[model samples]
Target chain A: MMDAWDDYSEKVMDHYENPRNVGIVEKANGTGVVGNPACGDVMKLTIRVENDIIVDAKFKTFGCGAAIATSSMVTEMVKGKSLADALEISNRGVMEALGGLPKVKRHCSVLAEEALKAAIADYEKNRRDISPAA
Target chain B: MNLIYMDHHATTPLDAEVLAAMMPALTSEYGNPSSNTHAYGHAARYMVDSARAQVAQLVGAPRPDDIIFTSGATEADNLALKGIAHAKDYMPARNIVTLAIEHKAVLDAARRLQKENVEIRFAAIDPYGVVDLDDLAAKIDKNTILISIQTANSEIGTIQPIREIGVIAKKHGVPFHTDAVQALGRYEIDVMRDHIDMLSISAHKMYGPKGIGALYVRRGLKLTPIIDGGGHERNMRSGTLNVPGIVGLGKAAEIAKRDLKSESERLLKLRNRLEDGILRRIEHVRINGHPTNRLPNNLNVAFAYVEGESLILACRGVALSSGSACTSTSLQSSYVLKAINVPDFLAHGSLRFGLGKSNSEEHVDIVLDLLEKGVRRLREMSPLYDMAKEGVSIESAHFSRHARGK
Candidate 1:
């Protein structure tokens, strides 16, 4: 593409311009960090849960607009969904949520999905570690 | 409306004196510098020689005869690499050493050479873009034909210790070439004192015309010409001398030499104010490159959670570039940033702000304000920010329960 961002939808631009979720969450059920040294992007996701419902979601991303926006959109998509449903949230779904991404920015959506999955896995493992002999 | 031109590192406006000097060559001096038979040819030849002297003086070279004009830095770089490599056709061993953060003019040249079974060794770099001198020293061996590095980086504006690198190369009996396109008038350089074998410079970088440049060759260095023709440029390059360009280059160099020190100081002050303002107003912003060994007018910063391209687009009226300018062609980001170990996340969010003679304190203030507002707005729409505010780490919420955004 002549311009990498020219292909982004309005929703993608919106999320990129006004990202929904950003910052950090401490001492939570799970946390995940993803970094791509090639592109110089880093992402850290944290989540809180209460009885199978995510209470809150936050992220700290050191990436471009697409990466940040994708993270924000992913958090919004998974906020109230069950862990199983969130895990099923593919990168495609995140891209769809933002109306689609430029081919170059495809990695941004992938990173968002990976971060979410990583965080969910962390939460599941934590629950298993603290379970009362279920 | 005054259009503040702070992107001098990108390209400088042609100096008026240079334009005046070039007019006669363009209008009446039509004979080729190589054509020794006519007045036109003699005049063009003299202009070319005068231009060469001007360029040599700016770089502290001993004589004008040591310089060879080229299309620009890119061509000069290619000639330095391929010309030297091809010259060693009689030798069996072929190896090259260069830093990871070199401009594509060098890096891509190395890459192309590698395709021909040449062994390429890249020196590691610190986050500040300094070549690991020890690592470079260790990589040197008998077969090491050339050590290529740049004087100053265009992206982060990091200045490499070319003199030190030259000494190391000499110790190993290797030829040293530096692409000083970004360093020509901005920094003090002496080809002989620094022990540099070959140096490339472009006119546009120093307020001369574009598509005109020169390469400095030490008195005794031997290399074949990459371009073939009527034996111009002392049989090193073949094209007829660009008389108008040469005259323009000479005038520009004279002007740059006269005003360089004061202009640099002014640019430094403006850059400092801009940097200080951004650091104070923004959260999670980091400056890239070494504080002390960088260009006075260049500033690179990482704004967390914001994309460099987006920021540039939002600030469309600002007329600044994002990192290396060359990497704008690819989604892969800047090779300079990658080589310096800038994390992909931060690299993607990197912004390159180069100041020029046209920029003033007022321009800096405007840029600072626009940047602050732009980043804040982008952060607000981020879902990650919302989740963090709610005291939830995405990892914990991922496995047990998913709360789809309401």
Candidate 2:
């Protein structure tokens, strides 16, 4: 029988145990929230973008180990990347960066991707509202 | 790091004395109890009979012959429900009344009977998981053949009023069956006093070997056999007796009966310490199940902002179980919790702490420290906690609908 911890990869455990950038980005231009408490997982992603480049990223998540790890990994992956490159980061990309997640935990990675998209969308909306003719 | 096991409701480590008693049966007493013509057979039969008496004594049965050994509680549950349902004497009665929060053993067996044209009526339970006696009595009719309820719940540890339910069943003239798997060693159960017609119990839950259990049937009660063969177990169950496991179970039962009072008091103290520490040290935690009418060893709590699996993983050395969707294969929270109308969020955050004989005050302290750190850490990362702190109404957040769609 598989022990509960056996389902997680070493990378997943490492990230879960030592999550990086685990707070909201101060004065962030964009913020995204996905998932909900009812499903037992939720994620909030915040980003600081300057000159169309992602300068800082942080997250707060309520979820299982996979959700926390994927949130941590997504934030790390998006930092220092251009907005276009960050937009291209998929759930599979987050999963791969952490070696691999159990099949059931794959959805947690999707939450990470959606939170990123929502954050970027928020940033774009803020820019559009600030200057309609940009 | 030494692992502290608080999941005793799942199973317990075999007792030293039980193992010592089982050694002779496992090594030299290798004989079929049915082979009455040989010395080996006589020895095995003697052990089996002694084990049966021990089990009978533990449950306050009138006779040892009333105990029918089986593989485990699941098998015994199946036999009880199916055997009584298929009995020619009660075939005309088609309804089996049971509680909605019963273990899957009884519920699934009842479901199987449903397919065979037998009606299965589930009675309602209170928020604390106690059966509503009035509702249960209302569900039973003239055609009801059996009323199955559990001695106690595994997830929340709510002890039912079994004797009252038994009296109701007796008044209705329907056979009462209880899955006493979780209550065997923790509580005193007398089949005669409780008015129970049949009861299922397992050994592993009481520090005995696995794959051994028994069903206590009231004297003079008639039921059709679920398994048919050489008419072992009074023609009710037929199989070669498991000599070693039986010996272990008997020894375990003896130990349990000897230590029942003192052990329960000790476990109750540990459970209270753990529960009190969590309630005092943690924020937004809700205790589940009955406050006073619960099992001495069980403490279930739901931390407001943290997911159960995350909390479990964060507390690495403490072995526990959760009623969270994340911990289950079907991605659904505990049905027992749901049956009691615990909200989805709280249900997802629920964790069960089943204290056992091996636990000590030092162990409880360590677990408390771990739980405090884990819940605090997880809450720090939880967006839900942030919203709650900011005075946002969680029920109005509208993210729950999106979660359900997944």
Candidate with the greatest DockQ versus the true structure: 2
- Model 2, B1-406: lDDT tens digits are 5688999989999999999999999998899999999999999999999999999999999999999999999999999999988884445658898988888999999999998889999888889998888999999988888999999999899999999998999998899999998988889999999999999989999999999999999988777888889999998889999999988889988998889899998999999999999999998999889998899999999888899999999878788999899988888888988888888888888999999989999999998899899998998999999999999977678651253355
CAPRI level of candidate 2: medium
Q: Say what the interface RMSD of candidate 1 is.
A: 9.3
Instruction: Determine the TM-score of chain B of model 1.
Output: 0.93
In model 2, how large is the Cα lDDT of residue B137?
91
| Residue A122 of model 2, lDDT score | 93
- lDDT by residue for model 2 (A102-129), tens: 9878888999999999899999999999
Leading candidate by TM-score? 2
Those runs of model 2 whose alpha carbons end farther than 4 Å from true positions after fitting are: A1-3, B88-93, B400-405
Per-model DockQ? 0.16, 0.60
Clashing pairs in 2: none
